[model samples]
Target chain A: MLEVKNLTVSFGSHTVVNNVSFSLGEKQWLMIVGPNGAGKSTIVNAISQGVPYRGSVYFSGKDLAGLKPSELARKVGVLSQRRFVSYSFTVEEVVRLGRYAYSSSIFSGRSDDDEAKIEEALEVTGMKPFRGKSVLTLSGGELQRTFLAQVFAQDPRLLILDEPMNHLDLVYQKQMLELIRRWVGENGRAVISVMHDLNHAWAYGTDALLLDKGRVVAWGKTADVLTNENLQSVYSMDVYDWMRSLLSRWSR
Target chain B: MSKRPEGFKPVAYILFAAAMMTVMVLCICAGSVNIPVKDTFTAIWNTVFDLPMPEDIPWSIIILVRLPRVLCVALAGGALSLCGGAMQGLLRNPLADGYTLGVSSGAALGAVIAIAFGIYVPGFALAGTMAMAMLFAFLSLVFILSITYRLDCSLSTNTIILMGVIFTMFANSIMSLIVVFAGERIRSIMFWTMGSFAGSNYVNAIVVFAALLVFGTAILLYSRELNAFAIGEDNARHVGVNVRKVKLVVLISVSALISVCVSISGTVGFVGLVIPHMVRMLAGPNHKRLLPASLFSGAVFLMLADLLGRTMLKPLEIPIGVVTSFIGSVVFVYIFYSSRKAK
Candidate 1:
């Protein structure tokens, strides 16, 4: 479980996220939806403690402020939006970096369990075949999957993802969401993801928070928060009929 | 996935270490006063085991002269190469090194000032030129770091490298001024800038070697953290790497090592820049293997370069910097062409 209270983030005079708050229960998936610059990514970043914020984010009843970076990482795995690797490490090596928090020494930190987890993550991401290939040689979708595998190997209780499906094709997108659903189903984990596609939020999210210009437009169950009027007002488009048709099809 | 495990190859490391030692011995035998390989090995063994040196061996050539020069050369080369690798990892750029970052020029400025005014540390036998060089090197890095820090912008690899180039130009201008003033000693200044180990001794060599051992191990211990950093700073932080701490430790360690190298053996150009690139090409980009491999290969490269410097004209020795630059430029061209072709 994770709780954020009155979180406010700003850069200089420009406020990006203002007075937003939300809590994620165990085994729950919360999707943050908004148009461009709606501060969805900033909200997730504040919760993950990636940037300095004006409010408190508590993880499993512990204040995130008191935790060391490694301590915070033990319970939280974050998949950021942009990842750039200048060097050419093998895919396996990149995945193994997720074990850094579990490592006690530089030389002998990885255990048998860790290796198995790495392999399992690779398998789940469909990257098992390319484990030996240099990450530099991977395509954009493959590279995204490589990072997805890394986060999976981290084995954190709470996963914070910003635009997790950015480079993924339709099959991988469905596969990645299914994997997250299975993880929550099995391990009682929680997920907070920022998504631009309302269809994805409607299908995968148990709860949704709709934001507009750093302000919350609606929050509650995904279906209730993404009402036709709210969708029309937030996006300034007449999508009521389109949203209803899509929801009917998804429900069926 | 392949069934074979993926880690640094032990055989490659062993070969590199053996080659470095072999080249070291060959260098000792091929100096101005050519000592036999057998006598060189015997003297080295005697020194290692505290046995009495044989009377037939030339003590000056084996102990007083060649040994210290060779050790100094190897240590300087190893330290520079390691710093280069660490710099590349820290900034997440393959082209970063002391030479490109102006750290070497900063040390050269310090050395030039000391030589110009005849300023030497009294009663600190190994502390004269080296102490000044290290001081200026530290100051130069601090200046560069502060400028970047004060900008309060995310530190980009391009920005830091550009800062380094600017600092290099500034230092070079001052150095040029000093060179112009020293009408009679221009050749010595030029030789110093070109880099050499001809002026070293056993005392300074031992000191620099000890420093390298201590700091080099510290840097190696951060290979895992460096691996995380290779994925960009945000990912590194997300994965629990203390980005600021890692950067500080790496910067301090690398700057200290570069200062030590420059103090002992002027600014030997491409050993720092090209050795890491060469090692990465051979061993992939894992810092765990690349760091130590670069050290070994850099030692061999510099030893061969210094040897060529000594024997190319059979008495009219070329400068070590000249030899390295020539070889480095060729390697740079080859690497550029190959990388473009691969792409």
Candidate 2:
């Protein structure tokens, strides 16, 4: 299980993520939804140790206060919304970097298991065909999948993806969400995703955390926290009645 | 796809670099004087083994003067190019070079000031100037970097470039003022500005060669970290890199290399700017291969430039700085046009 207690992250004098507390059980999927500047990304960044925050994050019964980046990477894999590569690394070479945390030593020869994991990640992400191609020349959807393959290759206990569906098409969006859901369900690992699409979050997430202006407005089971009134208030849209009718139809 | 194993590629690159270094050393030895290959080996053997010098052997001509100067040129060339390549990776800017951050101008101003004031015992003036240049090069780097850090803005690529230009202009004005006031030293200052490898001896050559070896190996050891840094500090940190530590290492190593090169060659230009980009064009930007390749190729390139400078005008040796600029500008123009055509 992963737990965050009173997580408060500030920039200068302004608090971007204030007093946010939550936990995720094994095999659970928690989706965070908020409008722009609602501090959703900041919260994920804090939990992933990408930014400074004033609180305690406990993972697997250990405080992550002074842990180094490599140690944190061993247990938590993070995929930020922006992905940039300055060189023309081949897809296979790029995927191999994910195994850096698992390697016994910097100079040690790669084991067969490492190669196997890489191959499996590529296969699962449907990137097997582009393994030898340079990632620099890939299309947007292909590049996103390549990064997903890298995350899968990492094989961390906890996966945190910030807007993983940004550049993906409809088919890739379905493929990626199904893949993450299956991974969590089968492996009993925790997955937290920050998403903007309310319908997709409701469809795929087992739990939901809603935020407004850096504070958690609601948290719990997806169905309960995603009520029409909460959606209308958080999103500031009058689509609650239409969303309720659609939810009822989907339930049937 | 077949796997070549994880660490094999970097080893191959190292071996290639060694081979290139050997070829460059031989080329440096075989110069306008046209010493036979056998005689060159004999001279090297006698010097290393401390054997009795043959009555006919030319010790002063071969070992004492030409060899040390040649080695110094090679060392400065390799160090400047390698540091330039690493700086480009660290700053994530293709235009970054050894001289880009005002280091060359700072060194030049320091040397000129030392010269104008005659800040040494009569015979030790050049040595004092070199020491002063090294000191000023490091100080200038620290000053610029601290100011940039204190500004509390993201160190964007354009901002770094702008700061570098501003600092360069400041250093240039100081150097110009010194040159104008000390009119009698203009000839010496002009010679120093147009770099020459005239008086390099074994003592200074050893110092330069050792510094280059240490700095080059240090940069190569951090090749993976440099590759991570090229993507940006935030991305590097996200990927589990200690960004601050890596940046410090790169900055210190590059600064040391530049200082040493300035001490020896008096601000030879364009090798740092052109060679690394040419290497990247050929080998891609992976520092694992790029660093070592730039080192060897840079040595060869500068040695050839030195040979041309010496041989082009037989009795009157041209300054190496002019030769390198002429050759480098031609190559750069060709590369620019070809890349544009490709686009």
Candidate 3:
């Protein structure tokens, strides 16, 4: 269980994320969709403690601000749109880095569970072949999977992703979503993803939060949040009509 | 071709250890006054065993001048490179080093002030100048980092480097003013700032080694955090690294190291930047390996560079800083080209 209570991120007089409050429970996947500058990613940044915000993010009824970095890491994992790595690190090494929260000291050896979790993450993400390959040498989609394996290995209770499907091909996009669905389906885990693709928000997200500028335009079940009126106000366009018209073209 | 994942190997370390020992001995023996190889070993052995003193030039050189200077060079070189590796990783900048970051100039200003005023403390291991140098160095690091955070919260490379350049110029201007008013102390100040091991003694070596032992351990302990840092601070945070705490601890440790080094031998640039790059290439980017390997490689590099400085012009010794800059510039150019092309 995770609760973000009235979280607000502001820079001087300019607010990026304003009074955004939401909760995520087991088996629930929440998608945050908005136009550019709507602060969709800012909410993700706030919840993950990537940026400072004037509010509270409670995880499993515990205040995250009071938690140690290692403790907080065991509860939340994030897969960002881009992973910054300029050095030459193998994919396995990158995945194993997720075990930092579990590891006590660098001098100590890895436990059986640590190794097993890493191996399973590698298998699930299909990054086994690239285990020994440098992260610098990976393709965009392959690199995305490598970091997905990293999050899987982290084994957190909640996963927060920012544009997880950015730069992914159609095939990889489907595979990554399927893997994430299974991940949440098994462990009583919850997820929050920032998505630009409205179709993906409809298909994959259980609940939705639509944002415009810095405020919430609509929130609740995906169907309710994506209604014609809600979409029109936020996007200022006939989104459902356009989608339905496009749907007719694909019909057999 | 894919590189096979390589982990810790005892053999590489064993060879590295041997090379360290061999290079140190060679450096000690091959100075302007060439001591015999046998005498060099014999002198060290007798001193270690506390046997009878040999009344010889070779023995005195090993006991008095060369040994202490070599020891100090090793400590300074190793610490400089270690800090460079950590800073580069933290900022995700290839060009980050003590000299480039303006920390050396700040420490140099501290040391210059101490030298100009003839500040010295009897009975204390670290002189008054070294203490001042460390303080100013840490302050400089804080100054630049806070400035970068203010300009850009991400601590991007360009902002950090710009702040560092401006700070270095400011510090150097103050140093030049000190030089102007220094009077008779100008020669010592210039020679020291240019960087040399000619003035090193046992006290300087031992004190610096103590500082390195304390702070170097701190940096080495944060190797995991540095590894995460390379992947971006947000990624590191999600992995449970306390970024603020790590930043505080590592910055303090690195500053302390650079201060002690600059206080001993003025602004030996590029050892930190170059050695870490080499270590990462050889042992991979895992900080666990890179940190220790940096210590060893940097020590050897400095010993050799100092040896070249002493013997290059025979009667006229080149400053150790000049020698490093000469070599560092070439290597740095290669790295600059390669890193840009990588993008």
Candidate 4:
């Protein structure tokens, strides 16, 4: 459903993502994992057309760069590392903003019950109770859920999320991943997410791409790519033993 | 979630519009020339329907003098407030306005130069004044941005405001020089700088209203895009808002309207600075409501301010800028205290 060909991104003389190429078919959930400044967000930013890049990112056979912002947005929904809402807008209003590509003009208002897609999104994200709450007063976890509901409402075929659950609580993180799993279970839908938690990636990702220093260290089925050798080399630490030790701390 | 949040509220619209019209009509009866409210209404009705005027003294007052001044005041108020509302949305900072961005000073500089040299566009002095003011306003934004960029690549809020202040000081110094050299026009320059609606007429009123209608509607149309910025510009872009295009259209339109306002009533302080923040507090920060509320509320606020300035001393009128700054500062203090307390 999406393709990145020799994607290279840089800042002045500093190269952040170098000659990284990967592709995903429909129903695939590709998890990008790396340490700090591993260019996970940069790669996602490049795919979402938020940054200029040397290589092309094709979405459903169309080059994303050639599309208008609204056109690109129709096919791609991105949940960024969220920022705080300082104003007094309700969560519903913020979520409704995701439908900008579908709205007729900037002046158009939210549609009625007949077009209740947004309401459905709010429901799935478990933000139904807080839909009317002012986003400014929301806690970090609630705010993240509100934005997650927003991306859900955008109803794009491909979801690109950069550390989407960073602000979410543990239970909500599981719920968010479940929602994504359900979403990608459908036809013609896929996801590319940058995650910090290897456990979540191993558990949730069907396809995983491990990146180190902006280059792809391993890429294949999640089970194949997240081997002890691959994880140890990229992280410079023992992977399975560390998980076992952490589990032992709470063991009976 | 079965019940959607409120969308557009016609009640608020009707209420604001009615209040604006009512205040504007009542303010027509101000000034020492005591025209009765009945006469004011009759003259206004006659003029609206294009009937032949009654040819009385009150008819001339309503048709010729009071009407234009009132319109100019209302337009300036709406223009400045809308400019502030849009700037606050684009910058996602409540403090962003023409005054803080040095755009108002740039506009005042333009108006001052035109008045100093007696520059007029043949028969239309208003055009020359507005043209020069708009030019300087745009240039001032560009200059402030360029200088700020040179100093700080990130263009942080601190750097931008600092540049604005530096530019404002430099522009004011030059304006002072112009005021100093004016031998005969010193009185007019002083009045212009102080911000007043004295001797206004139909030409100034109609031209400014037309400009406001165009630019003001532009801002209103872009309100949704502005709403997207509430999260932050980067996220706004992620949601398909062409942030750059929205910013350019809004800022240019705002500067143009503000230039027209300054050309009419010389940098009336705090209408822009205070009105949007006040309206946002009352109406909530959805730009859809906030921008339009700023429009009507600003009109009423300025009308009351100008009227008070005109009548408070009877014979000795206070400057409109002085009245607003005095009142606005008090109201702003209360807002700060209340917001802090709420926090």
Task: Provide the DockQ value for model 1.
Answer: 0.66
Regions of candidate 4 where Cα sits further than 4 Å from its true position: A106-114, B1-14, B42-62, B114-120, B145-162, B182-193, B333-343
Best by lDDT: 3
Interface RMSD of each: 1.6, 2.2, 3.3, 1.6
For candidate 2, the docking band is acceptable
Given the true complex, what DockQ would model 3 score? 0.64
- Clashing residue pairs found in predicted model 2: none
Candidate 3 similarity to native, TM-score: 0.95
For A60-79, candidate 3 gives per-residue lDDT tens digits of 89988888889988998999
Candidate 1 residue lDDT tens string, A195-229: 98888898999999999999899988999999888
DockQ-superior candidate, 1 or 2 = 1
What is the descending lDDT order? 3, 4, 1, 2
Per-residue alpha-carbon lDDT of model 1 for B226-327, expressed as tens digits? Answer: 778767777888888888888878877877788778777777886877999988988888888889888888788888889889888977878899999887
**Per-residue lDDT of B142-258 in model 4, one digit per residue for the tens?**
888788778985455668777877887888888888888886764455565568988888888888889988999999888888888756887788778888898788878988998
Q: Give model 2's clash tally.
A: 0
Candidate 1 chain B worst ten-residue window by lDDT:
B1-10
- For each of the candidates, the C-alpha root-mean-square deviation to the true structure, in angstroms, is 3.4, 4.0, 2.4, 2.9
The CAPRI classification for model 4 reads as: medium
TM-scores for every candidate against the unseen true structure: 0.90, 0.87, 0.95, 0.91
